[model samples]
Target: MTTTLTRPGALAASGHPLVRPQAARHLTDEQIAELGVELDAIRDDILAKRGATDAAYIRRVIKVQRGLEFAGRGALLFGRNKAAWIAGTTMLSFAKILENMEIGHNVLHGQWDWMRDPDIHSTTWEWDFVTPARSWQHTHNDLHHRWTNVVGKDRDVGYNLLRMDADQPWKPFNLGNPLYNAMLAPVFEWGIALYDLELPEYNEGLKSKADLKRDLKAVGIKAVKQFTKDYAATPAVAMLTGSGKQALYGTLVANAVRNVWAHAVIFCGHFPDGTDTFTEENVEGETRGDWYVRQMIGSANISGSKLMHLMTGNLSHQVEHHCFPDLPSNRYAEVAVRVREICLRYGLPYTTGPLPKQVASTWAKVFKLALPGKGHFRKGKPASA
Candidate 1:
């Protein structure tokens, strides 16, 4: 959406066309159109090839995740034993992570809709998170993806909490930036649930009170179901076997681990060095080519093994995911090769690094932006494919 350029130096600091003239000078209008064409071809190729193999991949993930959850919960019934507690917690953590990252997130993105399986379809899959899938799709898929890194437009820039970008006016509350992020990591799902309610929109009169109430009701109902399953029901079953306290603690720890992992993967993909933030001015009169270019520069990737990629829901290929959000997550590695080639040909930055480096860079940004100043994060350097 178009927003008026109101923040002082918003354009200049954006490092985009209006912000920094030399930043993106390599791409002319004709070149951007050509880049879009190449990217479109990649997306189309994947779409055409989506078949039994892709379907099998998601099904296998679902089966494994469900099995782990069952084993974990069964183990938790005897969680009074030290070994059982450890095993249960570990299995539960993996199960929750796999469900949220690979199954829930991708399914809700409509990546598997082509399979025509209603049970796994985006409209039906309620993820293992606090936020309702529909609310997340509205805020994440519809808004955040559409706006990417644009200041004021993408609420995810700071999740309406921390001051992630210098363009965001610092407030006394921002003094807690580092602390806030640390705390947020353990309860990221709750934070996202509240964010998905769009409270700011309600305050600004953009959403009616009735609508806010409706959203709150949805969240409340979902929260009850989640709490009942994890806390009440599981612990009650354990109580019959005399391990209620242990089961409760196990589930709590498992959820925290999943939350922290999700937080780190998401931050690395978005806040790491080299990813660009834009001003609304950059998007005005934008074309398909310009949009494609924005996704390339606005996102970053994590370089690692197949297992790391799988754990991150293939979001380690963040650049590719943003370029083609609807494409199957299993195919991101192949897509990354072509995407990197296109970036090289276009002289665009393909920002990426190992997990540790990206996590450190993103955390450094959080600490730096906590204070009030015209501080700038380091620009991203081109990464090797």
Candidate 2:
């Protein structure tokens, strides 16, 4: 997926690396402690804010935010079709992008909740449907923060078989090749149900009972059953009546698009072939902080426009994201500066190519890791010991 993106709009300029590559290593414990201070400040703000009210002043704030997002696309969005949107931005679907930034990512990271409601704890295990938020917590917090691509258990590294880096066998494949699924990523959320959230908990849950696997399996079954019911309801939406159907259809279609969209972005993050997935034995048993450093080393941050950065929720800044999971996502541009310093300090491989480069790299990772070859047969023994 190496690209010669020296053209305009590319993250490269002439000969220098885009965005000034820099990185650091061995931050004093003081640095880590400082992050805790930052968290406390954010927590205090959340405690002071009041609830969302119809007549509240913050409604104005939310409205202003919406206006910013609406004008961002430069179109009046009142049930207009794609043809109407064509009159505005030419580069991307501004509405979906706005939704991702304004609604999806914030909810995923619980930014709105963070500074408004003090009680809501944004655990990686719950909340935020878009951007595969739980997956972010697991991939960023559990895997990157805790293990950071340590291979066997880190959970971020994929690309060895047809499965996603963090996928588990759902149904039988072809005994061998069949057990592995290919690029289920794009539409995996609809079909795989709670696979994203469930896998992390199952792998990293508290010390468990004798029937832990059985309990986990029950969750998986329930997730699929619910997803299937929802999927089947999509097309039948037109059949629903009254305002009830109108609301349901609108919600259903919006979610269908966003859920699928989130998976596509996330899958390309690391499941592709060129990305490396080092096991525990290879990287050694790294400490928690080392894992954060390693995830930045292995991950690439795809560059996009300012609006693209926000609407897409700085996912384009993938490296910064995988590094700082707790920071308000809006601040990635600021933290990214320090990341550049760190990369240079450690002589680490910090990849932050443009979108084209990121996509190409991910495509390569998919084929290289997913193609079943040599003794790639499944054990065929059901989920048993």
Q: What's the CA RMSD of model 2 in angstroms?
A: 12.7
Query: Residue-wise lDDT of candidate 1 within 1-385, one digit each (tens)?
Result: 1111122223344455432213465677788778878888998999999899999999999999999999999999999999999999999999999999988888988899888898888888999999999889989888888888888789999999988887788888999999999999999999999999999999999999999999999999999999999999999999998999999999999999999999999999999888888767666656667777778888899999998899899999999988888889999999999999988888888899999999999999999998889586523212210
Give the clashing residue pairs of candidate 1, or none.
11-19, 274-380
Cα-based TM-score, every candidate: 0.93, 0.55
Q: At residue 3, what lDDT does model 2 achieve?
A: 10
Report per-prediction Cα RMSD to one decimal.
5.5, 12.7
Global Cα lDDT for candidate 2: 0.44
Q: Model 1 segments beyond 4 Å from truth?
A: 1-22, 378-385
The worst-scoring run of ten residues by lDDT in candidate 2 lies at 1-10
lDDT of 2 by residue, 1-385 (tens): 0011111222122343212112323355355335334433543443344244312432343455456434523332311344533432221233444445444444445444444444333443232232244444444444444544445565444423344332243223423322333334434443333444444455566435544555455545655554453334422432442223333333345445555556556655554333344433323423333445445655667667886576556776667766554445556676677676655655555666666676665555444334444222211111221
Best candidate according to TM-score: 1
